[model samples]
Target chain A: MSAPIIGLVDYGAGNAASVRRLISKLGYRSRLVNKHEDFEFVTVLFVPGVGAFPSAMEALTKMNLVKPILDFANSGKPVVGVCLGMQLLADSSEEMGLTKGLGLIPGEVKALSSMEWHIGWNTLDCVGECSIASKSDGQNFYYNHSYEFQAPKEYIVGVVEAENPIVSIVRKHNIFGMQFHPEISQISGFKLMRRLLEEFTDA
Target chain B: MLKKRLTGAVTIRNGMVVQSFGYNRYLPIGKPKVVIENLDRWGIDEIFIQVIDRSAKSLEPDIELIDEIATSGILTPIMYAGGIQNEAQAAQVIRAGAERVCIDTLLHINPDEVEKIAKRLGGQAIVGSLPVGIDNNGIIYWYNYQTKEKRLLNDRLLSLVKDGLISEILLIDWQNEGFDEAFDFRILELFEKYNLPLILFGGLTSEKTLKKAFDAPMVVAAAIGNRLNYSEHAVQTLKNQLTSAPIRTAYYHDRSIFKHYD
Candidate 1:
């Protein structure tokens, strides 16, 4: 199968260069989606974020790329959100204050009830049978976040298995949101990403 | 459970990797890319790139070097230290590809700005770097290189840690850094009541010393400088020697993918 063009969202929040470089290293081509017009030739959307929530949403709003991105997700193309980007996929967040998000995924972002910070590496517990479940169960991924996605059980693909079982992976149709960083997750992350690329190609 | 982290703390001097001693002497190692590449290949938990010359020499964060490494497809998270004073500089460092920014001089110069930086770019992105020394009398003091003040930790630092302005505190032993087995775990005793997540760096090379540090519940990571660069697969070999059940031991070797990409 020909490689799908990864539309790396570059709104000055996440390090788009690193994600783009990772895509290239995966033998896939990527183009920065700073403006709405850049989404025309894109096959998949990779939303990467690491900063606060309100500022990230503000950058997306300022760039005027929110509606186009929603339109792309509504088109049934594969979309991946890493770390804070996954939180942005929710309906609202309470990072700095109550702020609205992209709303592609049916959920809300909340702070971890277990700990104030969840840094370093942790294994993901597969929930129901899904594309990521079969490939990434019991596998470790690097996670650096304070908040987690609070979604329903049906949409939850994987979780951290903490006292509260914080959501780590969420999926609904073609849109997927991962709270862990797959780009810098080394080999384990590569396996999940390869499966994601394959799923996108088959779609 | 979250696994403990082992970070490859590299001391870079003028775009080249160097071995730092006592924060005054520097022995050149090699290029930054080569050092980071090997560490990433060895599956180091995190990479702490401390450009010692940036803050002292009045230079900006090394964006070009960071861009080079990020473009090379490094999988480890990088904590960049050097000349990060304001929110703009911290944002620039993160945008350039570092997972977190370490502020040394700023924490001593103006600590109020650290809160702003943490607010702008989440507290997770900010790492409060503290270079401390314990005197013979057991007095814990911070080494303020800018004004040559060995001030007490109570001077706004302890407050910041208690308030959780930064995600983690990189407790660096500037006096004993690069000297193997010289790190004093006694300083950790002082912070026992605070319940702060600390990354212990400096003079932590030998297996015995590392094991002693991992015993501490608050020490999140062991940042080994100078010594890891001496041997091949140092991180893996070191972790292998210090293997305990709770410690993080797995690291992936994706040489084939990198080789194929090239």
Candidate 2:
């Protein structure tokens, strides 16, 4: 099998460049998923998310990327969303008075109940078997956001406890979401990205 | 559980990295990229860069610097602080690959704009930085280098914390920044009431100060600049010494990660 073609979806914001740089370090080349045509040759999709949810949704809408992303995920090709990117895959978010999301993985992004803003690094507790479960369980990943992805039980790949168990990773078929940033999570971030992307390639 | 952070800071002036002493005296370090690369390799949990002279010169944020670091393939979470006076500039900085943007001037001059920036980028992406010091009479006041103003924590600055406009307060001890055992603990007393996580910086290089500061429940991270730049794997070396601290174990600097830079 050939290597997976990675494409970073650029929705005006998000850390697409940083994620692309990480992909480079892992010996994989990626492109900016700007137009619909840009998604053609790519086999893997990465939504490098940051900032507020409303503006993020608006950027995706203005770029007309919501449908393309949905179609890509529906096609059974691996699509990964990090931080705000992960929240975007949900049905909606309560970030700025209830904004609608792409609804790909079925969930809502709500304000964290335990704390106003969960910053710093936190360890992820693996929830059943998923990508990197054997290796990534109890590994610390960088987190910087106020909202948490409230997905269904089956989709949860890992979680971090606060006053609540915040969903850190979610996987439903070929779609995956990480509430924490793997691109900048240091050695663990590198290993998590490499191990999972390698698995995606092997699959 | 969220582990406390050991941030590696880059102090830049004239578009070059430098070691700063009490916000005035400077020792030339090197290029900004080289310093950032070292911090990333050394496993610093978070990296924040400050171009000290930008706001003083009425300049904008160093986007070129941010872009350069972003594209350099840094694996550590990065933040940019300096000359970011408004919402658009903060957003621009984030767009340039900084996960968060630290604001010092804006938090003092126009707090309403901070609320707007928070509305746009959300609170987690904004860090309010106040360079503070205690006077000879044991009075802690926020200091402004541009106007040489030292006032008690004013209503505007307090409102930023009260309104939750910033995620954390980067309380910098400007007077004792590079000096050992000089950062006055009274400086923290002014902010302890706000119930916000604090990232202590300036002259907080010693293990005694870091440990004491970290012992406080609200103190989340201590950003060290001069001390961490002294040697190779300084980040690891420093963290290893604070063995009892809640900081993550430092990752060895592996060169093979960058070898296949595609």
- Which model scores highest in DockQ? 1
Clashing pairs for predicted structure model 1, backbone only: none
C-alpha TM-scores of all predictions: 0.96, 0.95
**For model 2, how does the per-residue alpha-carbon lDDT over B1-262 read when each residue is reduced to its tens digit?**
8889998889999988888889889999999999999998888989989998899999999999999988888878888889988889988998888999888887667888888888788788889898988778987788877888988887767677666678898989998887876777877776677777899988787888888888888899998898877799898888888988888876675677557444
Tell me the docking grade of candidate 1.
Answer: medium
lDDT of 1 by residue, B15-65 (tens): 789888887888999988999999999988889998887888888888888
lDDT of 2 by residue, A67-132 (tens): 899898888888889899999999999987899998889999998988878998999899869856
- Which sections of candidate 1 miss by over 4 Å? A1-3, B252-254
lDDT of 2: 0.85
RMSD of each: 1.7, 1.9
DockQ of each: 0.73, 0.70
A19 in model 2: Cα distance from truth in Å? 1.0
- Model 1, residue B85: distance off in Å is 2.4
TM-score of chain B of 2: 0.95
Model 1: per-residue Cα lDDT over A127-181, one tens digit each: 8788755679988888888898898889999888677777989988888888888
